[model samples]
Target: MNDAVRELYSENRYPDLSHPVTDISRLWVSARAGGLERLPEPAACRVLELGCAGGQNLLPLAARYPKSEFTGLDYSDTAIRKARQASYEAGLHNIRFEAADLEHWRPSHPCDFLIAHGVFSWVPDEVKTRVLDLCGQVLSDNGVACISYNTLPGWSLRSGLVPLVKALANNPAAAGLGDSVESVAASLADMAGGGTAHAANVQAICRDMVKKGPTVLPFDDFAPVCDAVYFAQFASWAGERGLRYLGEARLQDNLPDGISPHAFDRLAPLATDPILLQQTLDLLSGRTHRNSLFCRVDAMLEDGMTTGVVMNFAAGRGLVELPPVESRVVGLFRQLLEEIAPSCLAMQELVERTADRLGAGWEPSRHGRELTGWIYQAARLGGIELRSEPLEIRSHSMAAPRLSALNLHFAAAGRPVVDARHFPCRFPDGHERLLAAMNGSRAADELAEHARAEFPELDFHRWLAHLAERGIVE
Candidate 1:
């Protein structure tokens, strides 16, 4: 283990701070499940998140799938503390967080869904093997595990610079690796003369780092502790552990159609082996980030269906149903949906019917327009149903539209609103009211007080849980 890197992570330092959301996962899962295949029902699914930092990704999932239980584990005490604090502040009972070394920690039970983001490439080889072994041992027979990592080719260029940067830092005495990296970066920037080739190269690298900004992993803490693996090695390792590669979490990364005709033609022969083909494609494309799904050989792929179908059925739509929809003058909605899937005859008919009902020139309500677009794509691909009713009038709201209304509706209904909207029962009603009240103005405590009045039946803790799930008033 690189003590420097371990120290860096120990201090809760990693350049990238972003977390995963099901909205993004839904798209990937939908694409992998054959573009529109209905997902398996979400109820009572057990999920485990490895290296779940501060519960940023897992907590929202717990809130959304109240029927599903979630557990998150991380090695960092600081991160565990933050995650626990966030969960406590939110008042969530379905989610649990624990700090444990991945090598020895054992799950009390098998998980139906497993996720390990930003950990595969950082842990030591022994720890990585333990993680893969745990996934195989603890994942339910029908479970799906998402593992993200840094790949080769693209990292070839970036990784080449790591040694140079570390050498330039030269100060072993620096208390923090971040301080060393910044010092080196600054020195390189200063040495780059007015217009020399060497200076230009330095400037270019600096410029790329700046553009990547938050996306780049900082050296101070993370650089010393991380280990990146090639796609081929990773796939082979997991395959040995009884996990078969499903597909990339980012669906677009797997589409040969997106590659140049010549590249696609050259890579086409490898398609017989999905893992090899994807690995080669990723290498060819110089992919830096990937979310790969895996399952046991006997595990059936999740067909994206769920009870939320009732919401669509109640709305008089079918698996192929499309609601009336129109683009804004800017065609933003149209463009977004177009990227989703090709329009089908059923969708066109629905649009025509809606146009007839509202005048031909009528523009769809922003919420209606976005929802229709998502539903149209989902239907075309047979993905999960886009349930839930409208909350915000427009897409560009301060709070998530789904969170605002769906959460409140669930609280009012006195039960989970499984099909309330695009997301599962992630939000509660009091949070929706609080979101409306905040509009980026109200203080957290003030919002909590207002929620107490509106949902007297819900205690302060419940309201806080709703608030934490949405990351509102926090």
Candidate 2:
């Protein structure tokens, strides 16, 4: 095979697989079920993952929903072997991993869900076509398929340098391909020497590549055949296969503030055509990545949960701090809620509600009230509490703006847990004070003594136990 093909098959070429499949599956299940609070009635949902390296994503879903069957396919034997080993070690029986070229393989039965992450942008046109065709054929009437790709407009600026970099690296007489690419990048940085426009342009392209190249280029499992397509072309391509753009898999990316104002202004008017708008926005912003959802035209479109509602509810009950929602936007949210039918609880409805609310008025207080109600309703349905303690619950409609992102660590029923990723913690309540006291600086006994003096009712030991279980403390 070719050098590129060899690199793609090597297991050590890329970072360890860490897509957070368990979290993603939970969100998918919650969204499909209507909201995060309600678990969709158990159904035999079959999931198919394309280019499922090491089966990391598939295995988690299979484990979480034992009733749901999962099948993962990859072209790499190394990946398949690792996946099999991991499955055997974990004793997972609900998943199967196959080493088959997706371009030639076909599923025997229809799938309830399809997921292809980091696959679309890197595969050859023939493979891309087959993947979509398979999705169309295998996806059930009510299923959803997620396909992530690198888009045009955003990619154009960054990709403009690909040819130059590749050409420079291909000069085998000079150095090896990998060494040449790195050397050229370094040379360009030095030549620019810091301020000239030529240097700036070269530096910008180099920086973009440096940041994203490792994730998508020759290191990608399907890199050998990748032919990145523009957003508009991709949408058209999917449309031809009878799949409609459903929105983005990463809900945050679809929000108005996700892109620059100039891009939003240009694309907002095209909202009636979501696919076109998404393409235009992506191009304008020079976005190189996308996480898109597509549904079959004949499939029944179910109203699904909205991220706004989920975040709002999570914030209101102290599960998380409220994210920054501008005062002007809050007003529009209220108006939208008023117009929507109470029973019309769908993903589209939430979007429309947000648009209506923002377009109607700008009252922060009223908007906050409505958001709180939505959160309470969501919590009631999901079976999770908004707040674990009376101290954690906020009685007023005041927003506790997010100060920092928190790293969430979770443990299975009996597993020992500790926070692995260091995240900035923002406490809206005295939780910050409590957190400060519990920092490694103090022993548990000392912290408990302080807790008794400050908040007598608070169980310091129990709090420490909870923190330990969550992997928040060592």
Candidate 3:
């Protein structure tokens, strides 16, 4: 980390900063979906996190995969303190947090997966290069790395706010970074006043800045060295460092669904090359942020699905039944959703269940193919997910569900959200109370009795089953 970078975070302290996507399993699955080679499984893989503030992002993952080893490094002492305290409280023995600058730190052993989210674009060029260098030095042969940064065309517009923010931030009377940025935003909106086209544009931009919240306003926008890299240049830089650009962590971004057919057709021929197509897409979509993945130069990134790929839902959104082109599969799909909705089941389990539901007369081989296609189509539509590992289901003899240590800790600490198999769950009105009350001693009846104080109509058993379906209740 750069001295100024360290000083900035150490002073202001980014509150509740964690990237849920940084989970190695999520990255591996995304990379595989993008047609990368087989990578290490999450269970036994060694994972490392750069700029891991308070371990909020990494600790939950650590708790989830206790068999895996996790290491979190950050230059800020305050970040290390909070992260260490949380680890102790959660009783996570497989992970360690250290306060060390990236410049001086070296990995003791090659890691299967590494992540550096929200750290790439904020530091100096030298540190950015050092990040790539460390990835080259430490990543396993088949390892995948996720590095997220602000990209161009999208940043081209947002960058205009930087100078305005810096100027106002210089004002001594301004309360702080958040306050100064807010002041500048208001002033810009006032100056725009909305009569001219440019004025309306400025006001829209101000609205975006306002929604970014206080932490982002100071650290990302107004910082002295906030840099934005074009996707092509970033890819070239990675190539120079002996790493090959794989794809984005968000699988949907790599697909062609976001743009119009005419626009894609026009741009496609002009940039026949895949890398150039990526740059063109950035321009077409006005994409400002990206979560990128990379692998060793020799690694072959095939352009199709890998065999035996496993996926699971990240959260429970009422499962959207696939649109019925034929009415025969509708009831079966609905039943399938009901069975797997509560837990993350494997692809084979899904196929078998579909076959069983269709009855003994149905041929398993023929129907399995049809069901697989439907499930994948549904997954592409966000109704299901492809998991790199099976969801870790916990066993409890009591009627009340046993929530994971991390989820319980998060709920007790008033963290408005928690992770369920890499999906985020925002606490509903009485959800936190229900989660916090699962101390291993509370049975379903006792939990319902406790929950009735705040939620008179709450059914603890149904709620427990709901949480189980989302993988929130262990």
Top candidate when judged by TM-score against the true structure: 3
TM-scores for every candidate against the unseen true structure = 0.62, 0.61, 0.81
What tens digits encode model 1's per-residue C-alpha lDDT throughout 122-148? 767777888899888987776767787
Whole-model lDDT per candidate: 0.55, 0.55, 0.72
For candidate 2, write residues 1-474 as lDDT tens digits: 345554666644343343532234333533343322322222367788888876655664565457878888988888888778766756678889999987678788887678887777676666778888987888777667778777665556456576677777777664643465655665565566658755676776675455544544555322555456777788788888988776665444554233655656666678677767776666545566777777777755445554444442222121323343445554444344334312123333454456554655534456545654554443433322221111121112111111111111111111112121112222334555656433245566776777799788888677665454333554
User: Which runs of model 2 end up more than 4 angstroms from their true locations?
Assistant: 1-7, 10-15, 20-23, 26-44, 167-180, 186-205, 211-217, 220-222, 256-267, 302-369, 372-474
Cα-based lDDT at residue 325, candidate 3? 57
Better-scoring candidate (TM-score), 1 or 2: 1
In candidate 1, where is summed lDDT lowest over 10 consecutive residues?
387-396
Best-matching candidate per lDDT: 3
Better of 1 and 3 by TM-score: 3
lDDT of 1: 0.55
Candidate 1 Cα errors over 4 Å, as ranges: 1-6, 13-18, 21-39, 171-180, 183-208, 211-222, 256-258, 301-474
